[model samples]
Target: MQIPEYQLFVHPSDRNELRKNIWQDDPITAKLTIGKKKYAIDLAYRGSHIRDLRKKSYRVTFSKPSMFRGAKEVHWNAEFKDPSLLRNKLSFDFFEEIGCLSPKARFISLKMNGKNEGLYLELESVDEYFLGNRKLPNGAIFYAVDGDANFSLMSDLDNKVKESLLVGYEKKYGSEQDEVHLQELIFMINTLPQEQFETEIVKYINVEQYLRWLAGVVFTQNFDGFVHNYALYRNGETGLFEMIPWDYDATWGRDVDGEIMEEDYLRIQGFNTLTARILAIKTFRTHYKNLLEDILTNKFTVDYLKPKIQELHDLIRPYMQQDPYVKENLNVFDHEPAFICTYIEARGNYIRSQLDVLE
Candidate 1:
């Protein structure tokens, strides 16, 4: 493969190591320049080997960040070696089939040193939000990339977010609060009049968009659809929370039982007919209704979604031919029918009870 020849600034030690081929475990390092900026560069490993390199490095996504003096634009060039590259690309593209509502990185194919590489993604840095004429870096407002890190204009997870999310329950909610998981938080918010409660929940995942997200989650078997992965950006202007999904490295039917059949995907996510009813009767009705609505009606529900699920089956079907990982697991994508049946029935009944409210 022809290399893209991305401009770079190389560290002397890294350049020396590459020249000597001494860095076996993590070889291929360089400082790459893009436009007028330079970024730190490092070799990323995915799967086993680069498309051409005989050596195998899997576990990291390699990239060189543009590093230039007083450079404001940040650019990175690197090899796509992350184990989850395919799924990440699919997730970004999935938004295209569904009306994309969140920020996504653009992917481009590149080559280096006769090795085939993939350009993963690039994102514009988002600075602190401006409030009125002043900049507010000290509010309960915070943004988290993943579950592990939190980016805040403020100091900590003080009362700001707690106040917004845990309204009316602050005295009982805190770091010491254990009962309020994301589900319960949604339940609590549902308790308020739709107009009042929506004021807060809308800041994260609105009623319509959330339904689509739920459908994606159910279809993809994305169990980690908690608050951390999908976050709420409080638009200070609209005072509405917008839901955005991120960090989708665990889907694509990788962890499902092949013999289980695809019809039960929703059941696995706790939306099956039997479990759905048991949970609804035991839990809040409105909450379950909201959750089911978002999943069943999202645009992706029909667009690339069904086709994507079918593609997953196609990808696994070939692998099952010989790969030991899926050799005995052939029925990985059969849960679709069962989930559709169960969700429709369960959600239909729930909606009937709310005809007055919905209309």
Candidate 2:
């Protein structure tokens, strides 16, 4: 089936206002239509650099969650840095294939004021609704909005607060004002002795599930995800934290700025404070190694992923050609999929070789 279309209409004055405050979180009213259904939405410019770009990313919050596609909030990613326009979609697909809670994504054509904005990746917001969709219990979800929330108990570079190490995380679910639970988790991670870390960590986190999510991040080579670009949720039933991957446009052998990354760009150890501690435990390290091996053998190899990449590339090729933002350079769109295939093969090999030396 062809990708769906989004028609957004904003009054000239409101649009101008949004344009003026694109760097800020100010949202303006807009009318959004999909198929024959219409919605009233508060549209705000999203992302850091992309907000200043011609084809901008946006955060669309519907008046009600059920208003459109049963989602209260959604993001339209410009994918400006990624020429292939497949990094986020492919990365999330891999995460789902490996059984992680990642946001659902759709490739859609976005038009504003009847002008073609470009091909955008529509993503589901990770909120209570997302947890419900996964049949997961509603709990606290925090977004690592800045670089400092790298799961470390140490104060941020700015030295925010020692007691509340939740400096960079923005609470998306549960009580925004409460930092006690989050701080406790951090305290355990930082202060717990190495001998008791494994036992204590599992009490506050789904250890195996977290290892799987960590594997996804490492395999995808998403450097940003180790510290930022993830949502941490406390499961209501288990009272343990789990990770949800987000903003994967910087993955699959690409750095956050979309530059080509080295095949071994991320080390298996010392990526972050939490991960370093986890890997320090022999049993946990062995478990993580086994997971990595399983993925490389079964799912992450070129033989398994090449066809999938080809299928997605073929499906989106025509739309990529029509996208005005992508018109500046056609070569990258055409060749990047092949580059990805090569990257997958090389990355898998590199990880396999480095596993023994990681400790």
Candidate 3:
């Protein structure tokens, strides 16, 4: 496979500025080249704890909006933690298969100032351009940056009453009116009575979309995704909010640290304030159960997923030997496809066994 080459040219002073604050999204001036085309870009280091790794992740913003593959901004992750380095891409593809709107992903070779940076996973940014690419109606997008986005009235940061209804979400694309809609949705979720919430929640959220997204997270066993590592897209056409998956590197039988996670690590229902209320209603709960059942019978099977896993593994294996991070986990890297297939078999059986609990 001929992976795309992404080369960045940054002044030493700007490079020093980016390393100053790893936690902030501050960017310095830079330029990037991709396939003989160069773009004026603002580059910044990205990720939470992954910043500590030798190989770092990056967020690149083009000076010209939608210039790079119809995206003004993009993320290039070192993927240092994943042995197979396929979890994020695999999860996104799985979400797309399940009829959910998800970011497109690919592997690329990266160079910084003429120095080889090995392999990186390039992710399409989820924003106005993302919806435009899908030809969806104009809408607002928000990122659930932390655990506080669990749709709870109480603040996860303090365990007290939240100061604002929009405490946890960072509005990536929205107007002043869109912000008001988010606040209203959070307020309604927290204040409504049982009967009213079940009957009326549908007006605020697309139940089918939410359920499908929930099923994706549950099946992949992304423990942190229920609260964070996702996005909210409020569709302008339907006036209903929908969920989008994000930062999925920590999925597929592994934790964020790339540790071996338990097959039953998370319950089928998934834990979160919004999910609790939605599953409390039997009709929505049954619909969710059916989605899971359909997925297990078709999408989440060992026979079906094994080929895809192997294909991705094979495509990246030759390149894997070149990545320092992949070299460190070479043994684990080679066995990932088999391990993932095993995980699918076990996870499918476990989910099938727990179908009754959804009732």
For lDDT, candidate 1 versus 3, the one ahead is 3
Tens digit of lDDT per residue, candidate 3, span 130-191?
A: 99999999999999998789899887778998888888899999999999999999989988
Q: Rank the candidate models, highest TM-score first.
A: 3, 2, 1
Query: How many times do residue backbones clash in model 3?
Result: 0
Model 2 quality (TM-score): 0.96
In TM-score terms, candidate 1 sits at: 0.43
TM-score of model 3 relative to the true fold?
0.97
State TM-scores per candidate: 0.43, 0.96, 0.97
Q: Model 1, residue 306: what's the lDDT?
A: 49
Model 1: lDDT equals 0.38
Better of 1 and 3 by TM-score: 3
Model 2 residue 141 lDDT score: 93
List where candidate 2 sits over 4 angstroms from the true fold. 64-66, 156-163, 176-178
* Superposition error at 337 for model 2 (Å): 1.0
Per-residue CA lDDT of model 2 for 1-359, tens digit only, reads 69998999999999988877778897998898989888889999889867777789999999833446667899999898887889999999999999788899989998899998879999999998888877888789999987778778665566555555777799898884336788788878888998889788899778888889999998998877877889998988888898999999988887767789988888766377788888888899999898888999999998899888888888888788888888766787888888998899899989999889644
